[model samples]
Target: MQAIAERSPLLSKYETFERGLPSHPESIKHLRRQGKDSFEANGLPTTRQEEWRKTNVAAIGRTSFERVSQDTNSLSHEQIRSFLLPDCIDLVFINGRFSHKHSQLEDLPKDIFAGSLANALVQKPELVEAHLGQYADLGHPFVALNSAFIEDGAFIHVPSGVTVEKTIHVLFLATARDGTPTVSYPRNLFVAEESSQVTVVESYGGFRDDRYFTCPVTEIVGLANSVIDHYRLGQESLGAFHVATQKVYLSRDANFFTHSINHGGALVRNDIQALLDAEGIHCTLNGLYLARGSQHVDHQMRVDHAKPNCHSYELFKGILEDRARAVFNGRIYVHQDAQKTDAKQSNRNLLLSKGALVYSNPQLEIFADDVRCTHGSTTGHLDDEAIFYLRSRGIGEEAARSLLTYSFAGEVLDEIRLEAVRKEFEEFLFTRLPKGDIVRQAV
Candidate 1:
């Protein structure tokens, strides 16, 4: 491990990085040590690696980014007002640290606990210590980097037989006044006990026009018969780099659903994995990404059917224009003992420009003969016939193209259960598309 770390220029400053963070409890310290050691062994991934073959991160590796200072709190409320959700419990983070003034945590139920992870470690050490680093895949370099600097993020726990009617929103904002490229590692933990139901929305957005980096990790656990719905929205600055990982585990008869929407960033990579640990579990994953003007977005999904009579489904779509690049790798695995497993995966991409490119791969590994598993991927340009048809109906060329593109991406957006969120996303997409003015005016 030391040999690998010594060869990389970016990792040579690991000791300095470790010294910057504040002190933590022994358990957390030990966990961070493990994470650092794991990072030392693997280092940053390269295109030579199978998982990272299509995505090259050499630019991010060569650049050095400063960690956000603990006392820095210059972000104004108005700066983040546009990104906030109305009438929901919002937990805000500035430069990776929890902001009490910006967050709303009062008037909560007696048995529920929802607040900062850093505070949870102090007030409820045992509760946090038990599940902080339990589900993450430490082998991944980005995950290890996040774990090594696990300082602050959102934390939520719902007890058995408790149902929270309102949604919980966790927002992370990145800003640097000195114009230095900064990095933030935000970790979130969510646990839903038996017979409980909860919905959570996690969002990352840039408040300032700064070239920064954000690497976040989220872990979710669903106990027996629990229902959990999760959504992640990433809208970083054009000069910013973003990478994230999400790990989920579900118990018997648990129902879980996750939707990931990525819209901004210079280079972005997302890895999402789920484990159906017990029988009769149902899991669904849906994702959408929009890339343009040389931007890059990559998504990797893996779902393991470890128990029998479990079902899993995944759908990911992308819209790329100009010289933008995108990647989608979806893998589903059914164990030998999981005889009744039902899994399906699909990846579709729509290219709007000749220079735009996409790599879509869908794979399945089934050891059980009785399992029903299918996977497919498609990458192509917009339908010329459809565009012509719309144009003949009095719509301009640009408007026709924009309408078709909107309809293609709207499939995943329409699946969103929240009316407010769905409407907001529709407006956001209409504003970003080519000839977006036409779409916006029509809407």
Candidate 2:
């Protein structure tokens, strides 16, 4: 019955959150109260909800986790350089707080306006409050929790008619020290006005703290005729738990593209939502997950077409090996006013071992008569014929399996237009695949 902010049992553990989750003293007060209201109204979701039934969150509540503390004495700068991305402006957030001293903003474009939500609260309170959480459905428990504890977050804005050449990258690296089970709510907001073009890449990581939980939320808004490319890359450490959300808002004549790539984590769930608010919008979503070991990964997506002449295409594929498990829930809702809307969605998964399992559900809810929408999903094992084809070329059986598996996963990787970035991540995925072909011989 009380606010999440007031009754987080994990409080008194992190001094950073004790400061009332910093914000523009006056302007953000109202929004903070609203977040508290939203969170209390809808607590942690349950299996009773269709979207949550497959991906259970009840067990997580049993284990208490503190907010990531600001202790970083054990980590060195040299240790973090290995996680850096190539040729992009970079910002680093350590332990749920922004560290401008360790950031690389020299590479950022001149037209873009970037700042920490903490600073933006004081300097541009009205602007931050106007658009923050404007596109997300706070009815979701995780999103509401993130909003209630609005502490450290990244904010970016690209004005209309501006063409940004370089991609903006944000890295959230949280570490749990002193045996404090922790969680980081890394909130990020991106706004692109009419005709603006930009690319944003976010990588989430953690230091060998599997007991730690990272619940992050990203919200984006795309205006008329705007073109936006975005990516969410998760490379959390071995013992980490990740719960993240990707929300996008599209206006008339706008175009949006998103790719979600997940490599490693103990338990990971990603919620991606896109709201097509206007007509003539083009949106494409491509996601892939290679979860191995005893890992559990879930990807859920919702796309809503509220107006006419909107087109959306979604393709999500996954590879599960060992005892890993995955779940995918993709839903497309076409409103009555959304006529002539062309929407297509597909989810295909490949399991390398019988122990691995995948649960997929692609649903279509159409209320319009003149719309064309189709949805389909399937889960299968590696293709025997494809493996044989590679073996016929003198490749060993084990090598053949690896080759076929990579090719199946490569379709989603190739969707990434950035050559260098894609290549780095491709190599990362190669190491995760079962040893064979290039991986074994190269090692």
State the C-alpha lDDT per candidate: 0.86, 0.80
Error of 1 at 434 (Å): 3.8
lDDT of 2 by residue, 1-443 (tens): 96444444433343345464543565455555576667666667788997788777775666688765455334577867877877877777776677776678886777677757777777777667778877777777887777767777788888899877888888878776677677778788888988999888878887664567788888898999999998888889867888888899999899999888887688899999999999999999989888888888999889999999999999999989889999999999999999999999999999988999999989999999999999899899878887888789787788778877877877888899876568777777576665633753533
Each model's number of backbone clashes?
0, 2
True-vs-predicted CA distance for residue 227, candidate 2, Å: 1.1
In model 1, the runs with Cα more than 4 Å from the true position are 1-25, 207-209, 435-443
TM-scores of all candidate predictions against the true structure: 0.95, 0.93
Distance from true location, Cα of 133 in model 1, Å: 1.2
Lowest-scoring 10 consecutive residues by lDDT in candidate 1?
Answer: 1-10
For model 2 the local lDDT of residue 403 reads 74
The TM-score that candidate 2 achieves is 0.93
lDDT of 1 at 443: 55
